[model samples]
Target: MGLLSGVLGNASEIEPGKAQADFAQLLIQGERVEKAYQLIRDSFVFTDKRLILTDVQGMTGSKTEYHSIPYRAITHFSIETSGTFDLDAELKIFITGGTHIAKRFNKKLSIYELQTVLATYVLR
Candidate 1:
């Protein structure tokens, strides 16, 4: 349960003014980030124009992949609150062209905030 425990404890909510410089560097010139969440080495950033998903891979964290999903392409998203039986809350994004992205957060994280943030952006 060592690895499982570590994975379950990795939901780090990124607060304003505490975001990493590298994450901010991923932003475009006029883009602005409203919310961010860090999971171990990976992270998700919600910007004014789109959502930035960063995947950091490799043994030494040398590789990085950025996924930019425009707010217009986000058709809908769903949030599953964690329960006593299931200790993980999940947020799923459904984009255009039938693409789906899911991120799981620790039970302590506020998934509803994420939902509201996306709704404000995507429904605009």
Candidate 2:
């Protein structure tokens, strides 16, 4: 997301890691990482069993906040695909514990891929 978007709560995808580096250390046994992205200075990671959000705080990135949400916790989600008049796609998710996450994607991001992940996980 652009600087303006960032301040406005806009987020961009973090380039996925090559070979989908193992996340077993971060995930419960048998869970796997499906995708990863950087949202500003934070990390947005999607896994087979949950979504992991990593936020770095402090001017020097001295603090880190890790949020893990299981698929079962996702109560609702919405997606807006890029269009002729729209330069970016957006996603919003509402989950248990009153948690809400929203992010903006560049026009090049694949809506289908994201849809698949949401459908298979959140809808299961």
Candidate 3:
């Protein structure tokens, strides 16, 4: 009986630890996402360059798709907090010609990858 009680107590502690880890991961991911978005948005040029984008609209989808044709691609970025735990981000981009390149980033990423991606985008 004593061993069973000890095991149950340990198991209960496991749940809180797992939850804490999950929450911590969420925070980290959120920060990464925000940083990536900002990097992309800041790199865009509008007036200095002639950019035209058409058919821009937000679509209803599983991963929050913001689609635009001519795909100017993230000229402006803003992060808004809808709730204590919810974040909303808006982005504007100027699509050059008719080509829109889409890039996807993972939240669980290393610092090296983050730096590389930002550098690549900004330098281009």
Candidate 4:
């Protein structure tokens, strides 16, 4: 990801293999990362079984929180593509119990591909 994009709070797509390795301890047997996105200090990892959100906290970045949301718990989702003036794409995911998560991706990442990945698991 470009430094400017990170400074602007826009996320970038990351290698799935790297995410898979970094999160191997949290995965159940047979679960694998299919896609991953990186922010400045956090990351979102999509796996065959669930979505993993890594939140790096504190000034020292020593504390971290991992949140997992299963595909079956995702009630619905929406994707907004980048427009002529709007340079960022956005994704909103609604969970089973009124939880909402929104993420913005820079123009460099394909929002359609992210939607496809979610649909493959959520719609199954």
> In terms of lDDT, which candidate is strongest?
4
lDDT of each: 0.80, 0.76, 0.27, 0.94
Query: Deviation in angstroms for 4 in model 1?
Result: 6.8
Instruction: Report the lDDT tens digits of candidate 2 across residue range 91-120.
Output: 888998887888777776786688788889
- Candidate 3 wrongly placed segments (more than 4 Å): 1-95, 110-124
Candidate order by decreasing TM-score: 4, 1, 2, 3
lDDT-based ranking: 4, 1, 2, 3
- Over the stretch 15-100, how does candidate 1's per-residue lDDT look in tens digits? 74555455667777866777888877787888778888888899999999989889999888999999989988988899899989
Give the winner by TM-score.
4
Candidate 1 positional error at 97, Å? 1.0
Which of candidates 1 and 3 reaches a greater lDDT?
1
User: Candidate 2: RMSD over Cα atoms?
Assistant: 3.1
lDDT: worst 10-residue window of model 2: 15-24
What tens digits encode model 3's per-residue C-alpha lDDT throughout 44-122? 1111112211222345322422232211243432222223432222222334444333322222223343334334453
Give one digit per residue, the lDDT tens place, for model 4 in 26-59: 9999999999998999999999999999999999
RMSD of each: 2.8, 3.1, 17.7, 0.7
